[model samples]
Target: MVDFTPVPALCGGLLIGAGASLLLLGIGRIAGVCGIVGSLLDAPRSPDAGWRTAFIVGLAFSGLVGFALAPASVTNVANSPPALVGAGLLVGYGARLANGCTSGHAVCGIGRGSTRSIVATCTFMLTAGVTVFLVRHVVGR
Candidate 1:
């Protein structure tokens, strides 16, 4: 049966926002996964690599810890490896083309009152809604 755990979800959202806020305060950088990963790859000798690498590592480590604590709650979908890879590639490409991602545009950008971010976030939400509808209805999940 499905469960509605609003407390955990709210706590998680608060933690994410707090983490992003702290990152912005400490390093003046947006805590966007795509931007962080992309910049890490783009600059081989950049000093920012240290923090960026640490950030990515921390994200992975957090997921591992969460999964360890709640194995059943962790997502273990059975999608094909190739399909996952293709989706990852498409998402990466889209993030690059969009100049930011959900984290950057929705969280940081909205906090900063950016018009572009608002537009991007709205567009992203609309597109995601349509995609989900199509997948669940037209494409049969």
Candidate 2:
């Protein structure tokens, strides 16, 4: 059986929107994680890299804090932690290759009236649905 929490989902969406809007309104920058990380790596001389690093660090710490508060909230599937980390790295690379993460493309991009973002968001949704279906039905592993 599956466990779904709509409240958390909605709250997360709202936070993402607020964060992206804050970044745009205050710093005049896009809240795309891949872009921010890439820029920090490739353009280390840029002044704005500090805030970007802080943002990424905060993101990492949020999960740690969440687990500290409610350890059960975290899940461990078939793979080990190292395997999951490798998968995450691959996904991050894929997101960069695709030019944006789901939050950046789906939430911020769509809200900004971007056609490319719209398509990218739709693609993300469709791919997610297909992956879930295949994992649950076809594989049954």
The RMSD (Cα, Å) of candidate 1 is: 1.6
lDDT of 1 at 74: 76
All candidates: CA RMSD (Å): 1.6, 2.5
TM-score between model 1 and native: 0.91
lDDT of 1 at 13: 84
Clashes (candidate 2): 0
Q: For residues 63-94, what per-residue lDDT tens digits would candidate 1 score against the true structure? A: 89988998876776677999789878978999
Could you tell me every candidate's TM-score relative to the true structure?
0.91, 0.81
Scored by lDDT, the top model is 1
Candidate 2: regions farther than 4 A off: 80-86
- For model 1, what is the C-alpha lDDT against the true structure? 0.90
